[model samples]
Target: MTDPYERLRAEAEAGRVEEVVVAVPDLQGRLMGSRLSVPYFLEEAARGGFGACVYLLATDVEMDTGPGYAIDAWDSGFGDFVLRPDPATLRTVLPWDEGTALVLADAVWPAGPGGGHGPGHGPEHGPEPVAVAPRHVLRTQLDRLAARGLTAYAGTELEFLLFTASYREAWERRYTGLRPAARYNTDYSLQGLEEVEPVARRIRRAMTRAGLRMETARGECHPGQYEIVFRYDEAMATCDNHVLFKDGAKRIAAAEGASLTFMPKFDEGEGNSCHVHLSLRGTDGTPVLADPSAGDGMSELMRHFIAGQLACLPDLALLMAPNVNSYKRLQPGAFAPTGIAWGRDNRTCPIRVVGSGPSLRIEHRVPGGDANPYLAVAAAVAAGLYGIDNRLPLPPEHTANALADPAVPRLPATLTEALHRWEGSGIAAELFGKETVAHYARAARAELSAFERAVTDWERVRGFERL
Candidate 1:
């Protein structure tokens, strides 16, 4: 493949590319940006950066901005922050979107009058990285790992439910009585996947063409749920692709007259999950998480990394499970972790260590389909570093099912609990700066507040006659 910039330039000159999307991953991991003409993008936005409202980093999922966030968009009069395009993330749009290319960007403060130097600045001049930005938050942790001469690689396996109803139809009916793409549990059953295969196949092929290496696609335990895994890459790049794939998958599904959701728990049945697989390597690319001579084939670094997960799981739950509905999927028997424990290839534990030698890694099963990949991966990296720095001891693996183990530590059972743990946690404040912690805590508060005020169907149904 040719250099991304060169290829884009050539395509644009030949009239094959017309528009370029400049996007930044918001707090909810949604791509928020504008589509620019290819000529304008190549001439100006590519280097000087495009202006976006600062609230992109400060607002809730509904784009509502208010007080108490780290960025405090309202206090700042909702000014513009620069979206500096990351050339490495440049790629052609999906198969269905013709004549368009997309590039992810970093949220940064504009250069001041004098232009001072600081961390998270642009290449030629200084423009501070929005400290609370999701991408910047993840980048901070990666930088910490780099200082220790280590690099992190990760892959995310996301599960989502497909509905035969179009998005507009689903919205019109308030998402009830809709037909699932698959009518029965399709777990590894070829016969039940007929309805889902066409859309899934299209998504897989399009993602491969977009430069994401496909690993596996399979039917899951739920009636309409499916899981797609992509080959792991450098942690940041993996997250970049993760967001792009999610956004594109939804668009493609809509275009096909179907709708898909990555919500953690769309219904009372099996829920969607995003299991993250992470590992460490030396700066030179030597695998550092595995040891062939060790009795268990686990290196000392691997033990500390696992220990860090146990130590930080409580404080960092907000990053893994951020939304109100997220906790609905983390309940017992939901196949979404309910306890804090680690085990060898154990599906029941939150941290499952798998593979061996160079392929060895930990699969963090805590995050659900709705998690922000950048924040969740950052939490993992931060916890691992804490363990390594403190020489934290790895405990005995929970050989039994962790969910049913009464003695095992419990993860926050609700989003409110997670927010309380995060807001009051000194560990969270230390790992991520106090400001970053506060910013996300406020985001969680907003979610909880919204849920509190809404009058749900359950409430109406239970009270209309019975009460």
Candidate 2:
């Protein structure tokens, strides 16, 4: 419970720290990094580490580096920016080599007047922050919550596949001979999990030892897939823990001569997702959702929040399913959700109402493992807040399949459609601002355009000979 920044500094001073890895995600949601020695990190880099231009958060998974960005290009000289460390996220790297420390940074618009922008910075569309910086938006939303004398607690289920080796090796083999950690569909199968006991057990322990509040690890639906749940905590802390959990799992798996992937769907039969569970509490520490003898045992406040989530679900589609490939997992009959519906403990529904006593809450099943946790939380909180303010009506509980019934409201089916809906949405305007939506639309359009241009193996193999 000590200050993470202070702990990092102390570790560095005591010679217990080795490398300090400062990372910010690029367009593909892959963590990019610059490693620094503990001494230099504590002295200079810890405050504001150096980073490259707008391309970091603007490019696609291929690092293709160009599309819809109006910010940077070959003609723009591809300037550098500053990655300002968020001291609150500075934590010990328990699973890394020889006492390392890890810290996450906020991408600053280090170019503009009054001197925050980088050197030789030209005129931009103003010194606005990048839209892919989800954590930044979440902080803004949390400030609003704090102002309302409330606190947010959250947890997310990390579902991923454990392959026998690294992605590079699997790709080289044409994804043909790769094996899942398990042989059978494990869904709560003890004997099935026992087959991959080493990987699962070590993952839990390593994450727990690294200061993550790991709850339990369980076998998932597909062969070689698993899900890990953690105890919920303050919203910010939970996001921090989620990132650490992913890092620890991948490191542990690699150490065992295997690889772990959070890809939404690695195979046709099995898919990975990150289901986020959240609840709100008052300053006096009372649950907002609990009210026995009420409908679904939910209070008026709970109903209002749920209504807001449903009404603004479309606007939030981009955050919940951010990547282009994410839409593929949202199809019906895949155990994924594609509609705006809630039910009592039903995983098939996009939202599930849980708890009977003082723990009542909603669990959103829309987000995949590829989602940005900060942005997802921001979208949820914003929508819920709108519900509370407007007192929107809660729809009837869904008993049947939501996506199957055209009457039930459904979410966008593609990233491009979602982006268009988001741009015109009042929720996006209120929560993220108009300019933010416009900027992100540019990013989304570029990604979609690039994807449209690339011919896939399916097209080459299926149509090349016949068509």
Clashing pairs in 2: 110-116, 110-117, 110-118, 111-117
TM-score of 1: 0.97
Tell me, by lDDT, which candidate is best.
1
Off by over 4 Å in 2: 1-6, 25-29, 48-52, 70-76, 111-132, 293-295
Could you estimate the TM-score for every candidate? Answer: 0.97, 0.90
List the global CA lDDT of all models. Answer: 0.92, 0.77
lDDT per residue (tens digit) for residues 86-109 in model 1: 999999655768889999999888
Tens-digit lDDT string for candidate 2 (1-467)? 75446777777778888778787755344566688887788778775565656567666566766544544455456666567777777766676455777777777776555433333444563434544465667777777877887778888888998878676787688776788888888898888765477888888877777778777888988888898898998888787777767767787787788888897866677678988888999978888778887856888888988998888888878878877878888887788998888888888788888877777888988989887777777778888888888899888888887768788778898998898899788778887877567667777777688889888777888999999
Q: Where's the lowest-lDDT run of ten residues in candidate 1? A: 113-122
Query: Whole-model lDDT for model 2 versus the true structure?
Result: 0.77
Q: What's the count of clashing pairs in each model shown? A: 0, 4
Candidate 2: residue 219 lDDT (0-100) = 91
